[model samples]
Target: MSIIGKCIGATVMAIAGASMAAGDPTGATASPQALALLGGLATAVSGNLAHEAYNKLGDKFGPLIFARYPEIDRNHHIIIALRLSHLDAVEAILRRFNESRSSDHDRERQEEAERVSELIKTYLREAKRFQGDTKGGRALEEREVLAALPKAFETALADRSGATPDVQAARHETEAQVLAELNRQIGSDLPPLFIRVFSGSESGQDGWYDLFVRAAASRLKDDEAFKSIWSAEQLSRIVHMLSLTAGKIDRVLDGQVIAAQDAERRHDEQIALQRRILETLSTEKGVPASELSPILERLLGHVDVPIADVPTVLANAVDGLLAKSKTLVAIHNDYPEIDRAINEARNKLKTLDIEGALTTIRSAQERQKELQKEQLRAEARLHFEEADILRPLYDHQGVIDALRRGIELDPEKYWQWCALGDEYVAIGERREALNTFNTALQVAQKFSGEREISVCYDRIGDMRQAGGDTAGALEAHQAGLEIARTLAERDPSNVDWQRDLSISHNKIGDIRKAGGDTAGALEAYQASLDIRKTLAER
Candidate 1:
């Protein structure tokens, strides 16, 4: 095994052994010292490991600790420090503990010393990523160092109760020195950004903001201005609430940035579409190039009109343009390019060839039918665009109406069928939704990609699952999974297909777990995790 692998194995065994040795059978009574040492060991092991490795270690060990110690889970300062990779704070914790026990010379003490030394060596070996050691003054330095300091200090003083007066005095002096430094770094007053709590799930985070607030309050509590109005506990609560509010504000700002980006993207697409429309009008509809600019400017103003009026607006505009183009044709010509067919039929009539004339008429009817179909398809496209606009507004009825209109005009559009089915689901019409989805499945199987067919199956599975039909849901998901597997195997380099395969596995796992098929669920979940792990590695 590699050096890091060996370190991981040793660390896990050591922690597990300690927990097992605890008198409490549940490992619930493991001493704070043991848990702190465990955290210190984690900090050391994760110092040299990749972020993925760090998370994996946490996932493996966090539950064992949290299940027995819910309070630690609630106030997970050490976990936050690990996440930040704040070497200074974590190292301080270990150094303080080791310093307090330095005079002990027992065999167990020596062994503990050896382990701590090895762990510190492991941590310092890759010290370049640590704060102040990074080469290029990397822009992102961890602030959780400051946030983790209070917990570090608290852990350091955990053994103060049994210490001699001199030792206790020394610890108190160290605390004052650290608090003074903290007060200097963090200002006396909290910022206005943290005045309100986050909109959803206040205090629901894994105690990250709570830890931050505690660190800030630990320093601020000594401030003369803050001390005048608020007690220590009240100050802590206020700071915690403010931090949550700051998080909410940050999320709102992020959403605004995303919305701006999306709007710009849509604007670009609209410009391209408008350019194509203008080009078609100039070349195909015989509109003069000089007149196109003014006509386009007028048409652009109509975009402000409501979504329901879009199809009618589009049809009227196009029909008026077509009428204008038709008037430009010669008076004698009822249809462009039909003159030859008319001439042929007249010649046959003159020759008394009634059968040939009838054949020409039938051909003309077929041509008219093709033109009518083309017109219907054009109208359908307008309705589809209307549906797209309505979707974001959550006007489900409008979307259903528009999609249904489009489907009526062009039944071959399989995606429209699927979309219509989704709208049916939104309206709580399960029977109609199922029938529509089945129709979509049939259409998708006939003409769409296998991916779409799989999507249909997944949707059907969701519906069945919601209706207490676990077996049916599993069957449908398994069908989708088979298709996804095939697609992924066919093109191993395609990230999308690989992701689809993983999603299929996860869905299957969920269904099996719901149905009490624990073994099958585990197998499916493992397969999904394997794919996701490979993807993450890449």
Candidate 2:
């Protein structure tokens, strides 16, 4: 025997020997009677008979051999079967192997199963086409069919996923038409091999259809008889068509499986939604149970609510509960007061004096306003008095806080705003002082006279000059000067207004001189001198 053959034989013998030794009834060796029977059988078997006997022995222990060593390929099994001359046994074993590998849960196995199914269909169609045409017409017919198969498979697999029922039905109908055409071409000449392999009438349990197609295609490639009749190109075309058909089948089957899974998922979601609704209703105590009865009835209606629509329904119900809760809380908290008001209004309506009732309501509203004003004034007085006490202790911030409260209570009080701005300036908070003074000026213009407004402008200009903003100081001083001039023009005999104008002109001159405007500064000073002269004469 060849070196490889001898090695395989040795391996098999070693496995069998190990099995026998492990199962030995006696601790030492085989029984005397069993040894005598083995000696006789060995003596009778020789050469080819000995090899055949070994093959039989291996087959009897096939499962044990595989269990002991799983890496053994189909080639090894074929060698054993050929040696024993049990080809049918090899076929049965392979059939079982293929069936064992088939699974709906395994994607790769499902894809492979689909591939073999399409290959069988392709082989049947090609065989029919070849038989229908004469020898001279064979090549042309083969080319036409080969060219069409790829495009047909491509179109079928393109939108296989999420296909509507009508689309799926149309595809199946197309496949049926193609099969019927093939049947017509072959007529009564349909080969028994083709019929047996392609027929779908058999029960699908054994998974023999896929096994037979794989075996037939493999055999045809190696068969000398087939090679003589079909060109290399024609055989290649058959192989190509089988490949395309397999891919198409896998795509279609995958889409169908995914679609079924989606349907099941939606059903599960609906069940979960129903359970959630029950749980929510059981725990809910805020909203009246009677108000939610319609929602519950719709949920349990004969026509089921889709899972997608359940969230919106639940949200609306929650919003209704929230609104109702607010109403309930209001009624619970203010029930006594609301009840009294309503009773009073009802008594007035019963007296049939509508105008008197309206007048009474207005009078009550006016009194309420007066009381609110008195409360505000009391609060303001308390804060202002506290500030006066805190001010003697040098609590300038406390003074500002008190003044802010007084101003907030009565913003029309210009004198209080002037006091607040003066407080801000005393603390060296120039920015705050400037803003307060501007606000006070606005209020004074509207409520007080030019005296208060001019004082605010004069303070603002002093703050700007101290903060080194000469241009800003000039602007503020010029504004104060204009206001002082207006006041003095209105009452020339008023010494305070005349002095205010003179002070404003002097400040403007100082700012201009500080800004390096010699001529402008001189003119401003001359104007200040003229104002001071006028004030002195008065």
Candidate 3:
């Protein structure tokens, strides 16, 4: 296995082994002469000793041996050099391959050789960086190998090696194959790397983004075209979408950690409470503390004891003590309710009526929860009313505070989030307003609230427009317009829906006009005018 294959885990190594084992009859493993017949690299395997030479090369290179050598021979010395980390040998072979290429050599074959040679060179260069020397005197550490190989693979994917269309096509095909091999070499690291790269602080796109973009470009088989499409806005959208997924996963993991900590804390508290009660009972009864310690352990010290068994365990222990002493029975009189409840639970379990036994407690818990929810709902209503009162008074801060409180209590109410966002806009808090509106949009989307969703998009568009992001603004407005158009078509007689459609068209027109897209602006404006005219005539 390669150094990168080691870091990435045994799974990738197994896959690579499987692929080679499945048989590649056209590959160097078959004959080396067939490679010459396929692409005109007859010089690569010169003497009758070529077959013997290939057999001596070992499994280190696998299919790459076929891909790598064009004019270079199938001598096993290259394998020995690579094993000894002899980068100079690799470099010499590449230089020789390029030098040997001419008008006589097959152009397609030469380009494929060039592409594969570059991939090997690039990967070696990257892997050598951690070695602190240009000459490869030592092997790469697993961590360094893991870091370098993926980067090299991504770089090769993005690189345009030649000027001609044919060369570019050949390079693209070679890159796909090389990248697939790289994937086999480091597939285990990709998912964790993706999560790590995509999660955390929102900042400008970095090398990790490029790495993903490479994968996407390779799949599309158009590196240059794919790169051209990645405008600032497009990149931002991509980052946001990927980061959102990573963030969700991070949150779920965080929640699990917190829940585990909370459970452990509760268990510790329960053990402490049991110990305190036992200590008090022992002190009051003038019983030796050592005698009560075993009872406490039976009740709580055993960490594996199921919580459900606690009631029965305690009841049995108490019955045992009470049967042995009148003093304990007199003492148990003070805690008759606890004893009775435990006895009741134990009896229910014995009779297999567990649900019925817990009904009284569950009902009380449910009632308390209902009362709490009612209180919170009433409080949220007051805050929303306060926001409404403050809105007309031009107290944007007050409105924001009230709406925020209301949203905290009733997060599902998308309108409250929208209202809060409006207050942020009024206060000229563009980033805050944009984020709040996005939150509103997410809530609306969850419920499939089309009108609310449209409103959120329009608000987000407005913020983007004010921030001088014409492209982003246009996209957001177009999205809102799509939803508004659907609503208007579904009910043309609805005046509000028709008005919303007109406003959405106007928003798109405004963005296009600001962006110097005159024809697009005019078309959008005409649509808005037509909608208004129909509404006015009605």
In terms of lDDT, the best-performing candidate is: 1
**What is the TM-score of each predicted model, taking all chains together?**
0.37, 0.34, 0.41
lDDT of 3 by residue, 419-467 (tens): 8888888888989999998998999999657998999899999999999
Off by over 4 Å in 3: 1-371
Lowest lDDT 10-mer window, candidate 3?
Answer: 39-48
TM accuracy, model 2: 0.34
State the displacement of the C-alpha of residue 9, model 2, in Å, after optimal TM-score superposition: 99
Query: What's the number of clashes in each of the models?
Result: 1, 0, 0
Of 2 and 3, which scores higher on lDDT? 3
As a whole number from 0 to 100, the lDDT of residue 220 in candidate 2 is 27
lDDT of each: 0.55, 0.51, 0.52
List the candidate numbers ranked by TM-score, top first.
3, 1, 2
Model 2 root mean square deviation, Cα atoms:
34.5
lDDT of 1 by residue, 380-405 (tens): 99999999999999999999999999
Residue range 437-466, candidate 2, lDDT tens digits: 888889998998878888888888888898
